[model samples]
Target chain A: MSEAKTSANPLFLREEELRQGIELLFFAYRDFTSEADAMLAKHKFGRAHHRVIYFVGRHPRISVSDLLDILAITKQSLSRVLSQLVTDGFIIQHRGPRDGRQRLLELTEKGVEMERQLTEAQRRRFARAYREAGAEAVEGFRKVMLGIVDDPARERFAQSRRDGGRDGGRERDQ
Target chain B: MSEAKTSANPLFLREEELRQGIELLFFAYRDFTSEADAMLAKHKFGRAHHRVIYFVGRHPRISVSDLLDILAITKQSLSRVLSQLVTDGFIIQHRGPRDGRQRLLELTEKGVEMERQLTEAQRRRFARAYREAGAEAVEGFRKVMLGIVDDPARERFAQSRRDGGRDGGRERDQ
Candidate 1:
């Protein structure tokens, strides 16, 4: 990690800088989710539940397999929280129109409301960050974060960005 | 949210861009932690355990209260993970030299080894992100992330940044 410590050009990729990057990520993520976490706790749900809600809201009719892939969680693990959400009227899963065996997930109106509240809280924080940093800094932030994102997910996300925020149901991988 | 959707400067500060930023954070953090998560899971441990080990490794002789503050979790919640780590020989507790009543914590050699492995994985990703984005973009990433970080933590983190990653015990807030 210290391999490049002595290099000029003021490059900040040394071990020290790298560790700072890691710590910043930890602190930033904690603050970003802290609010929504408290909100989820009020519903007796956890971060896993929040992930399901946010994704279902973002990609209406996203299939169970697709969601599992996106969340990278096992079926059994996803099932417990998912079943609770459905039972609580937060999400509804329907049989795929084209395939009876396929389960397509969507947020209930109640779920959408919850999603909005959660996402709005997050977006407010992100917007303030962007506003404070200006347009150029925002791009740098995205570039670095996108680099942190693994491929395929990165590509899909970029596509969503290019799509101009037309979220959900539009690209349900039918 | 859509208030600035039609601005002429391509400001990317509208609801669309804001939502995209939110999604980027999700994807980036998931990818960042996924590897370490898998590693921790192999030991039947969870993210909570990882956080305890990482902080203990970083801050030798840190008291229980300071950890609770950094984690922003309940004493009961942290106690479960902390005790588990201690029982598992990953952490050790001692009476603070200056304050016998203060229970100071440090990582065992085994724990330090684990911390190095876990942190090395994360640092590699962050280094690649920094390398890919270059130094100019690195500042942008830090600026945006610092904005996401809430008060006091942000200031504390900046101080650490200025401290050049000496880490832990030096700033134990004794």
Candidate 2:
């Protein structure tokens, strides 16, 4: 069957090729995280810690609820990571100017430096991949990723995309 | 200074872009695994179990040592997942034809069915992404992923790529 028909119909799902994609996702993700995980491990942190530092560093002064929405995890999950970051002085949390219930998060100087190191390694990988793939492929990869996001998450993702534009996608790159 | 330089020099990485890549990795990966994780959770199995099942199913008659190599985990790690699969009748393990020390693995009928369901969700996601991204982007994504793979794992990935040629990259989907 034609590729278009096969994809559109869903009934003609090529089982074997799809499985390879699954494996690819597995292997690719394993490799993708290994570098950052090693760095976090050295710092006595875990992937959870990395996620918190990452998002907070991305949108400086972002509120707790906004972070919870972006990360799509329970407050408890975010609380554990956030508390650790705050205690360790990597992140500073303060009451929002307008909403006391909302905690605004920003990375400390040390936190910024550490986040840089962790992110730099990942950037090297992506930069290489993007360069090797070229602009067309990079755009394609982004679109594919956007398509794969779940519906609800997509809304949050879109909001981030809009906010990201104001920053010229700078926060996204971080 | 320019995009070209940033793209070309791995060491001269863009902090913002790199951070964005990290978030992309985090978000993309979470979305990527959610489908299978949900299915596995329903079965009281985690991702670890799915990995064991997937590799064994992919390489029928694969040996214990070979599996460890592919999984890049300790035998102890594989043991827990592998034993559960074997005990549950999802996989059948037999003494190697020539080497008694080596255990060869294959999926039972039930295992095959489970594998199908587990992979179908992922395949649908990938198929949609691939079609939306088009063939060029798909190729670039694969190339970028291949680049991210470390040296030791690269060989195994290459071997799989070759093996995949027979089914036109459908082995994993199956």
Candidate 3:
């Protein structure tokens, strides 16, 4: 069956292979988030809180609009999570230097600590997978992951990587 | 900075790269699920419903206990989604032939069509990524994704792939 499907498509868009890919993404993601979800539960937080602190830590001084863009959540939805994080002392909001009207988000020391604990669990899992998959596989993994992003967001994703590689000192938390 | 980090570790377990991987997974999974979420929303269904239909579609006649293990959701949580799907004529539950106490789950015609629509959207994304990344990258993508699964689940994941490859006649939903 796999052979027939492969033979039907020179590009190797076999349904069987594609289905496996779909299931792989589903199962792998389920497990990947479980660890961080467990950690967040201990802090009386949820995945939404983890996402807010994570992005803030990664992109220090990120504006609220930019965060909303990244999260693709409604302002009202974000407001609730942002409020919880701020009230819990995990995040700080500041006025943008260039545009005072824009609110910039950042992680406080406590927020940074929470981000570390959450990401540490995920990092260990990723590091192990990277090691097992090797350098070439890692490149392939990156290519596929990048390809999965929507067109407009793909540019932002690439820019973030470049920023992380070059300006490691800009953000002390991440 | 990347060079220094790489040079510092022979295993290539640099924190920077690992963090990038975490973000990649986050961004990719977010985008991937967003497409399906939109489709499910049109049917007045949520992600939980989509997940139940997906796994049941993949593994026909899958036992309730087995599905609970795969989803890792509370019995109450599963009960809610399962009851909804069954009531909506999207799923059919039957007693096990050997053990009458065991409830086996399968997608009805309506359920199968729903699964196909949802999975077809996801498959297009995966196919585009696989084609652009090429076979080697796809191999890497699969390897890394597989490695990320928990130890016990990894075995089930591989078995599912094998099942899909050989027994394509089952359900014909996925």
Name the best candidate (by TM-score): 3
Clashing pairs in 3: none
Residues A30-73 of candidate 1: C-alpha lDDT, one tens digit per residue:
88898999998998999899999988887778888888888888
Better of 1 and 2 by DockQ: 1
User: What i-RMS does every model get?
Assistant: 2.5, 4.8, 2.8
lDDT of 2 by residue, A135-161 (tens): 676666666666666765555445443
The lowest-lDDT stretch of 10 consecutive residues in candidate 2 chain B is: B165-174
CAPRI class assigned to model 1: medium
- C-alpha TM-scores of all predictions: 0.84, 0.83, 0.85
| Model 2: residues with Cα > 4 Å off, grouped in runs | A1-16, A153-174, B1-17, B157-174
RMSD of each: 4.1, 6.1, 4.9
Candidate with top lDDT is 1
Model 1 clash pairs are: none
* Per-residue lDDT value at B15 in model 1: 71
TM-score of chain B of 1: 0.87
Stretches of model 1 off by over 4 angstroms after superposition = A1-13, A165-174, B1-13, B165-174
Question: Model 2's CAPRI class?
Answer: acceptable
Rank by TM-score, highest first.
Answer: 3, 1, 2
- Cα distance off (Å), candidate 2, residue B127: 1.1
Please name the candidate that would achieve the greatest DockQ relative to the true structure.
1
